[model samples]
Target: MSTSATEPEAADLVCQLDNVQGMVDALTSVRWKRHQDAVVELSEHGIVLIVEESRCLQAKVYLQRELFVRYGYSAQGRPRFGVSLGLFVDCLNTFSVPGHSSTIEIQYPGPDMQLLLKSLDSANACIYAEIRTRIPDMVSWDYNFEPAGSTPLSFTVKSSALKEAIDDLEWPGSSIQITLQPVPPSVTFRGDGHGNLQIDFKYYVNTDLLVAFHCDHQVSYRYKYKFLHATTSNIPASVIKDNRGSKLTIGRGGMLKVQHLVSVARPSISHSHVDSAGYQQPSRIAYIEFFVKPEEDEATGNDS
Candidate 1:
C-alpha cells in the first residue's frame, strides 16, 4: 500500500486502508476573545471606521464575531443576513493527539487551523476551511463526524444494493470530531452597507483602532497584531528540556512560522478595470492565503 504523504499514487492505494473510529482526547478547547462594533465618523477630510474589540481577545486565542450584511439582487434590493459566523481563533496548543493509532496530528500544520477560523468567521462565506483528519478515498462511506457533545449531526446516504455488486450491509470507514466550547466571548464587527475590508500593514497601530472596526465603507478595517516571524533566525535559546516550558523552536520541525502579512482589501472588487463586452476586467484579486508547513515531528520523533 502507498505510505507516502506527498505522492499522487498514494491516493489509490490508501483507499484500501481500513475504516476507523475515534474518541476525543479533549473537547473544552474553543474560547471567546472580544467583540467590536464598527462606526464611522465623517470628518472634514474623509470618513473613518471605528472598531473596538474586547480587551480579552487582544493577544489571546479567543472567539470573534461580526455581522455580515448582504443586499439581495431581487428587484426590491432586499437586505438579508446569510450566516452569523463564529470561530475559535486560538488555544490549539491545548489539544492533544487523538490516540496511539492516529496520524492526523503529524500530517497538517497549526496555521491551517487558524486559516480555517478566518474563513468560517463569515456568513455564507466565499470559503470554508477546517483542519480535520481526512479519510481515505478507497472507502465509499461519507465521513463519520460526531460531536464530542451529546448532539448528533445527521446526514443521508443512498447506494444501490441489488442493482450493484456491493451490498448495503457493507461498511467502509469512520472519522472523528471533537465538539468544543468557546473559551472567551466571540469577537464581532459589523458593516454599514459595504461588507468589505481593506488591510494595511503599519509599524505601529494607534491604541485607539477600535473606531476603524466600525467601517461603513466597502473595504476592510485596520488592526494590529503580533506574530512570531523569523525564517531561520527565530531558533529558541534552548532545546526541548520538556513540554512544560517550550514555545516552539525554529528549523526543528515543531516551530510554526509567523509572517507579518497585512490582509488588505478582502472580499472586494476594484473599480479601476477595463470592461469590454459586458465583462468587467478585474483590477485586483482579493483572497486570504495561508500555508501548512511540513511536520517537524517527522524528522525528530519516530511516532510523534
Candidate 2:
C-alpha cells in the first residue's frame, strides 16, 4: 500500500506557497543555486515533474510517491484514498509561479491509523515546486532591463529569433497572458496592401516578469485598438482577442480610445478597407501597437 496516497487533501498543496503556522514532516530539498536539479516533461496526455539527483537524499519526493503521500488516506469503516498529481500541479501553478515558491499540504485522513508516524513528521515547513528565485539585485553592466518612461527599442518581429520567441513569446513569464484575433475587413478608408488586419499581443513584459528594467517600472499606461483614418462613433463595439468587457470604444466610426497603453505610436489597432468598383479591398499590416509613457531614465537610453 502506498503511504502518501492515504491523504487525499494533501494534493491541494502541490503548487502553492503560503506562510503557514507550522512546518512539514516529510523529507525535503533545499534551494540549491542551480534548479537544473530537475526536468519538466510535458506531453499531450500528461506532464511529469522529475527531480534528477544522481545521489539519493535521505528522503525525496517522486512523481509516483508524491501523489500518494499527498492524497492517500483511510477511515474507520472504509479505507478511501485519492491521488492525482496532475490536479496537484494544476493547483500549484494556478497559485504560484515557475519561479521560486513554497507550499504546505495538510492531510487528515479520518481516524483508525495511529498518529505517531504522520504526526511526528516535519511540521515546521512546507513543500515547494521551485525554479529560478535568485534574481540577483544587480545585473552586470553589460545587461539592461528597459527602465520606465522610455521608448522600447522596436525589434523586427522577424529578428525575434527562435530562442527569444521561445523565452519571451512562447514560454513567457507568468500572470500575463496575451491573445489576438482577426478583425474583419471594412470599406471606409483606402487600404494599401499593407493595411492593419490582425492584432498581436505581449503580456507581463512591462509589469510582471520584466519589472526591473526602465521599460517595466512605469505606472501610467493604457492599450487601445484602432484603425487609421476611421471614426468609430457609429460602429458597433470592436473586440480584440476575447476580452469582451475590455474593448475600445468608438466615438466616430473610425476613432477609438486606446486603453492600457504602455508605449505606442497608436494604442488601438484596426484595418483600413477600400470599396471601389465591385471589389472590397482591405489592407494587410505587419502588426500594430502604441507607446504612451512618461519621460524615461537617461541611463537606460530606453530606445537604444
Candidate 3:
C-alpha cells in the first residue's frame, strides 16, 4: 500500500503594524474584565474585534488595513475566530515599550490554526507568541440601530469631559437618564439615588466643548449605570490627551451608541499617502464603538 503526503495550508492573512502602542491602546479601550473572549473577523478592508455582555452591551474595535504597514489577505471569505481578549491584549502589551516603538507582524491560521504574532524590530532577539483560537460558536449579536425619530438625536463632546461626566455621575445612582431637547438644543445627564446630580451641555454655551448636536424633538431614556460606564470607562488616556471627541447617539427603542476614535499612527512611521493637493496626510485611525441597551422600562418623555 502506498501512503500519500498531506499538504499544509497557507496562512489566510498577514499584516504588519508599525505603531504597536497605538494598537494596544485601541484594543484596551474595549477590553472589559467581564467579557474575556472576543471575536475577531478579518477582511480585505481590515480587522474587527468584538466583545459583548449578555447581548445587551456590545463593543467593537476596528483596525483598518490602512493603519498597518503592510496588509495581505488571501482568504476566500471573512474568517472569524474566538480568542481570549485578556490574553491577546496582555501579549500585545508585552511587545510595546513606553519610550521605544516596535513593529509587529501578525498572521492568522498558522500551521496549527493559531494566531501568530512576532516582533520584527528587535535586533538580536525575536519575541513571538502563538495564541490558540477556536471556531466561533456563538453568533455575534447585531442590534439594528436606526435613527430615534425624524431627526437623528446625537451629541458629540470632548472625550475627557465625557469621561469625567460619567465618572462623577456614578455616585448618584444605579441608572442614569439622558434627556435631549430641540428647543433648548441641550443634552442632559441626570442620576437620582441617595442624591440627585444633573449635568447639561448646551449647544450655544461652547461649540468647542459640545462640538455638535442634533435633536428634533424632546427625548429621554434611562440606561443602567454599569453599562453606560463600561462604554467610556476603559478609554485610554492617550485618546483623552489628544482632545478627541466621543459621540453619543440615541437610536430606535432608546438604544444608546457611543463612538470614539483612537489614533494608531505615529509621526515617524505614518504619512505614506498624499492627497490631491500633494500634502502628506496623517495615517489611518482605529474606531471603537459601544452599544448599550436602555433599561427595560425606558422612559420616552414628551415627544413634542
| Strongest candidate by lDDT | 3
Worst 10 residues of 1 by lDDT: 16-25
Q: Which digits, one per residue and each the tens of the lDDT, describe model 1 over residues 1-304?
A: 2112233222111111010111010101111113322222222222122222232111111110111111111112211111111221122221212232211111111232111211212255322234332222221212222222232211111111111111111222111011111222111211112232212211123212211121111211111111111111211111111001111111121112111111111122344242321122221111111111222222322111
Candidate 2: tens digits of C-alpha lDDT, residues 191-303: 11233222222332322212111122222211111111111111111111111111222111111221211010111224322222112211111111112122122222121
Ranking by TM-score: 3, 2, 1
Q: Please name the candidate that would achieve the greatest TM-score relative to the true structure.
A: 3
User: Residue by residue across 141-250, what tens digits does model 3's lDDT show?
Assistant: 98888987877889999999999999999999999989998887899999999899999989998777898999888888888899899898889987787766789999
Question: Which lDDT value does model 2 have at 36?
Answer: 32
**What lDDT score goes with residue 8 in model 1?**
26
**Ten contiguous residues with the weakest lDDT in model 2:** 21-30
- Candidate 2 lDDT at 102 equals 31
- Best-to-worst order by lDDT is 3, 2, 1
Off by over 4 Å in 3: 1-9, 267-283, 298-304
TM-score of 3: 0.90
